[model samples]
Target: MPQLLMIEDDARLAQMVGEYLEQSGFVLTHATDGKAGLALLEAPTAAGLPDLVLLDLMLPDMDGLEVCRRLRALPSDAARLPVVMLTAKGDPMDRIIGLEMGADDYLPKPFEPRELLARIRAVLRRRGEAAPSARIMRFGSLEIDRDARTVTVAGEAREITSYQFDLLAALAERAGRVLTRDQIMEAVRGRELEAFDRSIDVHMGRIRAAIEADPKNPKRILTVRGVGYVFARQQD
Candidate 1:
């Protein structure tokens, strides 16, 4: 069972989402503010960190965006945690800003619990899977050695989990094509499950770190807005 942390100021909404996702088999943790969520995340856990984060952009104490920036600044080995911003603000610019701030995904408030569950599953699936090949995959200065199970950027080796490697291979294999959240989930899993999961964003985040010089402003692995992901570069 993958653990999840839900950070939102609205107690009622938090409880609703927590209960809904819990019913879907995910263990849940809740925080009423971004500061409190940050505290819990920094605290040690016997089994380690939660698999994913559900963050609310509005907070009483501090901006959720700042918290996300600080979290991503942590050492990669600390967890490579993925965050999903849950906001009521519907501005498209806000969504883009959240992505720039390192959020793996964003869900506007009043969204369906099923959509949230799907997003959670998508992120978790990426965390749990492994690369499909051992052969090194290349795209420009990036090199992902599937066999070595490692990635190299500018000839320097990078630390990436098996899931991350797998996500990168999937994108590289079909460079320039837009892969919807469902398409990515299928490619990563190599089969079908429920079509509602959002783990693809999590896996894509890992890939962004491997190849993008500035993941906050990724030039590769670009989001297709309300659809899916696209390998921003053209094929050879």
Candidate 2:
């Protein structure tokens, strides 16, 4: 059973979600405020940390975006932790901001319980696949060590969320191939791309920022206009 930490302020909704997730075989730890959630995340416990976090954008004490920013600033292991933001806001900008802040995924409010469960499962599944591997890939100044699950650019470590790393790895592994949005989502998360889903584009931008010497003129992951994106077989 995967453990999940949900940082949500609405007591009633939290309870309902907790119950639903519990029935789906997840062990949920609920925190009503950002402070409490941060405290739990920072303090090492005998039980170990939760596998994933379901963070709400609206919190009582602090904005969820601030909480996410702080969370990503933590030391190695904690900083790479996967986060999925829950928000009532339907605006695309809000979702884009959450992704820009390092959220692995996001779910809008009024979503069905099943959809939440599916998202949780997908995120967990992707995280589980990050164990060290024996292969290492090199692209000019960029190096991806599968055995370490780490990437370095120009021999220097680059900062990227685990989710973004996975996304990059997926593309690099299939370099020279143009993968559609659906293909990328299915390959990374074992899920179909939702209609008008721009999360992948946001994540790709972040990946470029970390690895490309000049993100504005990226030479690694290139867009195919209406088709999708492809990782360059050759890089500078």
Task: Output the number of the TM-score-best candidate.
Answer: 2
Give candidate 2 regions above 4 Å deviation: 133-236
* TM-scores, one per candidate: 0.54, 0.56
| Model 1: per-residue Cα lDDT over 19-133, one tens digit each | 8888887777888887788776776233335778889998999878888887787653223678889888889998898999878889998899999998878876765574344
Q: Which residue pairs clash in candidate 2? A: none
Q: Any idea what lDDT model 1 has?
A: 0.74
Can you write out model 2's per-residue Cα lDDT over 119-141, one digit (the tens) per residue? 98898788768754438888889
Error of 2 at 57 (Å): 0.2
Q: Give every collision pair in model 1.
A: 118-196, 118-197, 118-198, 119-198, 122-198, 122-199, 123-198, 123-199, 134-146, 134-147
Q: Which residue runs does candidate 1 get wrong by more than 4 Å? A: 76-79, 129-236
lDDT of each: 0.74, 0.83
Task: For candidate 1, give the lDDT of residue 110.
Answer: 89
Q: How many residue pairs clash in each candidate?
A: 10, 0
